[model samples]
Target: MTDYEKFKIRHNVITLGKKEYDIAIDKFVRKALKNKDVVSIYKIGSIRYPGLSDIDLIVFLKDRPKHFSIKKFSIKNLSAKEKYMFMHEIFAVPDSMGGKIKLLYPIFSLEHLGGKKYDFIEPETSDFIPFFIQEYVKGYMSWPDRIIRKGIIDEREIIPQVYATKYSIGIYQKILGYSSKEFERKCRQYIKVAENLREDFYKTKKDERDKIIIDLIYLTKEINNAMFFDLKKYLDKNIKTKPRTITLYLGFRPNIVVFNKHIDYMEFLNIRFLPSNFSLICKKDLSGAFNDEKLEKAFEKRYKLIEQYDDFIYKNNLGRFMMLTNMKSQFNITSFIKKRVSKN
Candidate 1:
């Protein structure tokens, strides 16, 4: 059998019937390719369970087009809401020639559909991006807790979202690298627990349902802990400076030492979020740093510390921090300055 045939067979086994969906998917791909700017389209995410998961397609473009739309292409399998959501997702991606290709997970299966074959340049996997993803996914983890807090009795509405979050955690765990067999095993085990819990949710009563949700939350925590253990260890060892929090934004330096919380640092630095570059956070209605001179001095000092961080990362062979800052900047650097940085 050909490689593509083998690949399709494997997907059929995973989806338990890809043949049914293939016709619609083929049509969708052909329709999507109507746009000249559409370079390639990729079907992402694991559609392991049928109804719970929706089709995720990543449409890559050569350049920013004047207009883009996916409303006309209809998938009978997908609800009107799902199609609308997919349209929004396609529109959300800022498609520039060399913009960072952010995936739902780093280790997603990118099945090519139609259009010219183009190489998708994913950013180098670093502590910076993964850490942010990890933090962001934590919001999903809190759904069960939120439901419980709000005295939500009918779990039928909330179960799907929880399942989706569990699936996402499993996928994102793949980016940590498959070096650790034990970590992978834990992920699978936790995901299986989540799956079982989801199935049982419909059959059980309110009390039993609550128990299931709690179990799901526990399993979710276990998976997250196992997944991020190595990252936590690395951060514990490396990250210097006690920033207010380990929270990361796109622009405004890799490490920002907050002198005062109130000051608009972006305005102070005169940084804007460029299409090609990471944008600075908003400048208005912030508090903290009152003295402009002190804030400027703090920023300069922070830049020097960042230089030291770069040297340490390169020495350790951990890759550069998201292609930011001048690696060759002659700002007088030092070897790994150790400070008590907050852990994520």
Candidate 2:
């Protein structure tokens, strides 16, 4: 944690600048390694880019724990910041020597996918564009499509993860290289997104829908700038921004429709009344710029199946099953059962 101990990147190399984290990293890694349950430990996020006060650690269990607490809350003894970190269960990711996922710095337990599960981290780790393409196809495509079709477009947001197509295409080309099939598909996807944006834009008043439009514009630019060193070249020239020329007025939220909180056993789904937090998941801030509600809502319609899943979980005693198998927080019971039923 000291200055010299933190920045000395190598044993003897002087010019590598000030990355003195390996000792600290090894200490934690050794601790986890001592446990037979721990398969690997991953260092991710700010430490890889620059040294900082906090270090991120991802401990991948050989077998997941039934009750895995990445870290646990200590309201009784810990400081406020410590309590937050414990409750949220977050740590910085460390750097790797080098590899395909060298920059990714993921702690890989589900090793079959070669660091794929980490991709779900969102707007964090790395900007692998192909993943973004599919996510947008799923998330962005659904947003306007649902609200426009359902006549429910309002202050309520549809999806929380905001990304631009052009930048995704850009990163895909650079890191993963481009394929003709991939390129054509991205072009087609962007066209669909633009078409949706345009149709939705015109259908409603510019003033009323201004926040959504601005959200689209803002996230695109910010992600592009932060992710792309050559921002101009990677810009999504194909997806033109055609905001209406109406005078810029005070942008208001879409209609705030609170779900009836009084659930008689079954919870009626609606926007969570909590004020929006920008972190992707419960203060997992590495996910830069994303909020949680939209992402959760993006799948709310699908979660209608949760009723069946709830029955399924209780019938199978999934909470106990999860503990027995070390599934921990990683399992998605709803999606898991959906896949199982489809296969059967």
Candidate 3:
């Protein structure tokens, strides 16, 4: 069988009874293309993902004609709300020739239609135009290519799909922008928040620390919303944490940290009091449950330490302060030992 046939068969098997959805997409594209202003229609989202859910169709227009309207089309069985959603999606196409050609669409449509014009900030003879023009042109062209090839299209159909699929990539690049490094940095920040929450859980007394822990959990959700990337999906599929507490522990600090001077150890401390699992606090938790013997030993150790410093803490209301100091010391020493052993 041909590659396309094999792919179609494989996709059918994976999706089971959803083959009709794929067939419907092809029909929708053909229907959209019949309209005079419709230049092309590309299937995006789950339809392109083979076995994934949901289907998104990107209908591209050559120009925003005064006469053209999605509402005029007579596609059946769709509710008024669905029709409006579809029309909104079509109306979002960018106006610039380059943008139209690239076909970048995001959750929201592009607001600027008249091409990204370079402003003459200084004088007409300034050299900024050349640099701006060069950067814009490079971005305008390269973005569409990367999105089509890397982001969406399956490898086997790359040749047949290239022309039609170009718009998909263009839309994706415009939606995601072209900054993997910036994305990674933002992800790291959220992960740090998650790690901090986990650490706090382990260190704080459950009954006394509800307010701060709850706030940290809320902060994690806010970070997740702000980042709005796929890191949450990674956390969901790979890790186990309560939905309420997900924001808190989704990207907890690395289970182990290699000691390095450049590391932001202070930031780690600031977030460390947020709470976490026993495994994060005690290395021995990795093996199994804390036995009677281990619990007795731990209590004895704690009693001795409390006996040694209880008077000072009571006099100063330094209970929380002492706990934090002890937590930091343990973390640093464990981190140092781990690094030393890893090197050897």
Candidate 4:
């Protein structure tokens, strides 16, 4: 089929798919407005995507007295299937919005909307809709800039598979015990596959974007494993102790065991690292953990975890770990540990 004909087919399918969704949303909005409590219905998420898979609806309700408020608001008045579809659109808002709303209000605070069904009251103090829309627009507008900023391409041209090959080789070195020869061969193969996948994605050949993302994520995990292993080796060689019990705490936990002497090790090395991209990590009991401290602790923890087990730090390394401690306090555990561990 011609490109125009293909586009028409896709557009028609999407339009037909959204009919029921649009009707449900429209009915909900009308009913909400009639109650004289709901002030607005802010549509978010893929509804705004040029090619949306599903609709997202965020209805803002007016605040009511606690005694009169419904505990669990929901669209139970609607048919069971309708309610199910609505719930799906409602739950994913936080993740889609980048979890920024959590900083302002408790997630449960909005529970009334889904909890009390048709008789729920809105939040007393929530400008989340406006903020959400603003942030969404900002991100949408910056998409072009962000893609270009990757430094891989100057303009919107198809990316070469060579980059993917390099990335794959890097992954092999970091994750697998592949020798130079093996790594080179695998990298070349990866590049060829990546090239084919890229073309497929652009041409809409067979929904290859998701496959590419999955493969890339796997490769990233492998790289992380390699880094952790290397760090573990370094620690074993440098730290002198029999049965030195080293615990690698992963996830958003504020705990670290370091030799006192290694307190100044990061500064001595003058290297900066990021623990996790999602949340901040701090030393336990310390108030304000510097970037460097977090970075060092992150590296140390990663190394320890990898040495201990392949999956020990998998969850933490998935970009959700947070350290909760102040590394800038007058406390001096670094020196103490260094002295103690050194003697062993």
Candidate 5:
């Protein structure tokens, strides 16, 4: 099919109403089932939540389809870079980590074999910290960057961001082994917050919408900061670093704030594998920095749960090497030349 025609089909599919969307899903399922290589086809994501925004599917295939094609591959055999590339190509996430999710239509599908429903293995116990930090600290907190950093609030953007944050929090809670009941309790608050803010955004006057947006944004930021501070404390105790330190950042291209000292050095070792917006500071400097009793208790509780697992892979060095090798294979000079020659 022509690219433009494909685009038109996708546009129409995405705009489908509840009834039309269900029909499209049934049709897709039927076609997917017809393929002999196909095993199980699971419908996932917001659709399960009665969200009609887009459809997400995990399609399991018996073997790789064709040669060097992006279309089909066993999830078990995918390199880290290939997996990353696959997700980036399929999902409509923004470059900024915590931005709203908008899947490209007519469907965003992942082809896999010997994979769980999510097209990936469950995260290891050691994966908790980095996973939590990435989802909560970076993804949830960074959602309001446009409004918080600058005074620019897009009316169209608020509800989606809130929904993204709510979903991110819930997903992490479930993945990290929070009890179903606890997950409901913890996530419901954010759900309510998102729903209320969404309601206020649509119902409020133009002059008043910004205030509501800013208020909700700040409230989320405050909660995120508390979690971050608690997380930092956890890292300081559990993760061993040579020079005991914690680095706080102030801006997007964040300036370092260690204790009360503002260090203006851009080139420095980031102690933890934290996001770039943080810096390293002496542990002594942050002796009394965090004092949130509730957050600290909650953080410790989760950490103890992770500790119950015996076989823990903390630093994923092998995974990193595999990712680098995959990247080189795909993007090296030889591969680039091959692609250009083929195009010619």
Candidate 6:
């Protein structure tokens, strides 16, 4: 490959940028490719969309390590300025990025891939991306509490399947443009139905609301069924090739921020009702029950801190103070200047 072709866009996708750290990923990926034992490397999480917090990944290796030792590779380090920013093997989901520079949590799996030490073999799987999508649905049904657990956040695991309809939207637009009469008609009908019913999902009964907890476990089975019927059909038909090891690099910066847009509820459709029959989406009951004492305490602590910060910023008229800048020094420039003048 020539130097000119190295950074060129392919298939309308851009994968290189001006930041030093963003460039470093290309270098790291290149090095990983040279390894004989590396089976595959998948780029996942916020990096796939806009407003990227960090480049998250999952590696499928010939052998899996017993424990993963990972490094924090921030494009711009915010440890001194942010709470819990430097936890070992933990990517503190930035409340807001300090700037546009991308962050790379450089291959957490690499941490445990010591010099020639190997453990379990990497599992063989056919539907890699589909597995990711289905897992989110299952977690919503089975382990909703873990989704909100404090500390290291995993966007790959938690981003609701409903948000991914945007991708389906993109694909349908392509189908429409192709002049496929039957397919386009069906696509338009499905989208219209989705738009109409997205607003009016039935409310949970009073008895269901007063349970020990109102996590999304109740909504999961619905999501999973949708995943099988609606999502599976769309994906299989569109992504109609055996997958390969891919390094997903969104060369341009995505414009969404985690702090500005934290997920309030799980998003998915009543796929049981088809495109042929438009139906409403299932949402989490917002009036939550915190039966776990530990989780309740944790929520209160985070809630109070955020509440105080919001009040501080509202009174000060300062910019939205991210968790990244919350703990940074608030030094008085006037006082320092006066002290310097006295010394002179």
Q: How do the predictions measure up, each by TM-score?
A: 0.48, 0.28, 0.26, 0.29, 0.44, 0.23
Error of 1 at 48 (Å): 3.0
Query: Which stretches of candidate 5 lie above 4 Å from their native place?
Result: 1-16, 27-39, 46-52, 61-127, 150-157, 167-190, 197-211, 243-344
- Candidate 5 residue 73 Cα shift, in angstroms, is 14
Write one digit per residue (lDDT tens) for candidate 1, span 214-297.
Answer: 555556655544444554444344433344422233222222211222334543242223212221121221223222334333
Give the Å error, residue 313, model 6.
46
What lDDT would each prediction earn against the true structure?
A: 0.41, 0.31, 0.32, 0.34, 0.38, 0.29
Candidates in order: C-alpha RMSD to true structure: 15.4, 19.1, 26.7, 17.8, 14.0, 23.2
Question: Which residue pairs show backbone clashes in model 6?
Answer: 50-254, 51-254, 51-255, 51-256, 69-111, 141-220
Give the distance in Å from residue 242's predicted Cα in candidate 4 to where it truly belongs: 28
Candidate with more favorable, higher lDDT: 1 or 2: 1
Cα lDDT tens digits for candidate 4, 1-344: 11221111121212224556667777766665555444444454332211123334554433321211122234555676565445433321111122233322213222222312332323222222211111212222222233323423211122222232343344334333354565456555666665565434445533344435335434433433333344345344433342312222221221122322223445322212222111111234222222234434433443332232213122213112111111212234446445655776
Candidate number of the best lDDT: 1
Candidate 3 residues 1-344, lDDT tens each?
A: 11221121111112223455546555555565666655544443343233323344544444443333535443334554333222223322312232222211122222221213322122111122211111222222232234323333332222122222233233323333434676445445534543443334345553333333333333333333332334234224433332221122222322221112223545345334433211122222212222334432432333333233334333433333212112111244346545655776
**Residue 335 in model 5: lDDT:** 44
lDDT of 5 by residue, 117-233 (tens): 332323333434433542345335655544565655544445466666665555445444333575456557767866776544435564454555556666566545544554555
Model 6 TM-score (2 dp): 0.23
User: What TM-score, to 2 decimals, does candidate 2 have?
Assistant: 0.28
lDDT computed for candidate 2 = 0.31
lDDT string, candidate 6, 64-111, tens digits: 222221222232333322212111122222112111112111111333
